[model samples]
Target: MNLLKKDLADGISFSGEKDGHCITCLEGKQSRNYSEELEGKCLQLVHSDVCGPMSQESRSGGRYFLTFIDDHTRKVFVYIIRSKVEVFEKFREFKSQFENQTGKQIKILRTDKGSGYVNRDFKNFLRNQGIKHELTIPYSPEKN
Candidate 1:
């Protein structure tokens, strides 16, 4: 620090470790705390997400899989599909089966703002069924 001051920076003052531990270091020693919210009732809230165009397809030539999760029961349902177009069909199938088994209609459907769930047909179906559709904040997959 003294060498640089003499050779280049004559006007600027450079302090080398003047204080003790930094603010960042103090914070880094602790873990983050997240607030907890109330969980919904069974079939009252459902989350759906789609993953794929996998490198290898399924035996039926499916390239994608759709997932549905129940918030209250922590139940998960999955369907293998050939493409994004099959999302609606698969969702309908899952909804029917789940409703039949649980005797409850899904009240809310939460999903990312992906094309498969954002299309017109998907929204229309949700509306017709009187189910609320929730899109997670754009660019925040953690919300999903």
Candidate 2:
């Protein structure tokens, strides 16, 4: 403290303050406490998304990939496809496999409001299956 005072007195300047003993800068900073609700296991909540039409196609002639992520287990299922049109079928496959493997039904289906998911057939299927379907607000994945 004396040295810093002397330096300032002598018109010496530094970019930031340095405590001689600690060799660190002191600056105004802020932090916040963040809390999150615990997430349940896989087969409990799944996140689904579709990605791509690559410049180049895969060996299977797939240009896109559909992903189903088990939120709790962090296990991911990726299905390659040539179009978004396959999302419904791929979702069905995921639903069947996940249900069979875990012996637990998918309680919710979440996805962006893509045409593939909002069509009459898809809406009817979800209604008939008694699954809760949640769609993200337009142009927003954070809401999903």
Candidate 3:
């Protein structure tokens, strides 16, 4: 273990040999990757995604989950939904509450453009509100 090695180098001791082989540690290590910089103002950019139809439903009978992340603040809001159709209503609620509380308008929204998000009604709402929609390419969720 690196901890044991550091302790030994620092003059700590143990009576017996210590084995360092760890299956989980060897399998779990990951290298860091580049990420975009944060936004300059709260509500300037928001990212959203929906994950759903889980094999096992939650106690509340919800099969989908939605998330909204404020790019500036890195604050996350999560909600459980019964189905993907709830995404538009949830976004309306999120936008209303977030804008009212923070006294700032959401200028841009980034998402993966799933059926839940790319509907005509949803696009109309964004345009009506003067909010820009940025859809990520398929298979590139990190773009959000």
Candidate 4:
């Protein structure tokens, strides 16, 4: 274990044998990869996605759930809607609430290339507000 090595280097002694395999050490070894930096606080960067037309409908006759995730705080906002057409209205509500609460404008939005997000109205709204919209390439949820 790197911790054990560091402890031994710092003159700390352990009664255990050094020849034995350390689970912690083995688990700790990993290849590093670069990850994108998270935007700080709320309303800075939001990832939006629509999930499901469930096999069984909800009590309110809703089948899909739209989720908005704050990149920095990892807070999630979920909206249950009957159709994808409601995404714009739900997103508008989310935008207002997030900005009101955090006092920060949403700078960028990341989402898959879903029509719910990339439609003319949504694109125009983002452009008019000077917000940067980022969309994943077709068939690439991993990018989003």
Where does model 2 exceed 4 Å of error? 1-40, 138-144
- RMSD in order of candidates: 10.1, 9.1, 9.2, 8.3
lDDT by residue (1-144, candidate 1, tens digit) is 234425654564544322443344455567533112222367898998888889999999999999898887767888898998888888899899988866679999999998889999999999999999999965565676
lDDT by residue (tens digit), candidate 3, 2-87: 64555543554534443663344455575433222232488899999998689989999999999999987788999999999999
TM-score of each: 0.68, 0.66, 0.71, 0.69
User: Candidate 3 overall Cα lDDT vs. reference?
Assistant: 0.83
Candidate 1 wrongly placed segments (more than 4 Å): 1-40, 138-140
For candidate 4, write residues 26-72 as lDDT tens digits.
55565433122223455678888888789989999999999998887
Best by the TM-score measure: 3
Q: Of models 1 and 3, which has the larger lDDT?
A: 3
Order of quality (TM-score): 3, 4, 1, 2
Ranking of candidates on lDDT, top first: 3, 1, 4, 2
lDDT of 2 by residue, 1-144 (tens): 545755554554545555552133333243322212123444666777777778899999999988887676657899998898998998888889878867667777787887667888788887898888878765565554
Please give the CA lDDT of all the candidate structures.
0.79, 0.72, 0.83, 0.78
For candidate 1, what is the TM-score? 0.68
Write down the TM-score for model 4. 0.69
Regions more than 4 Å wrong, model 4 = 1-41, 138-140
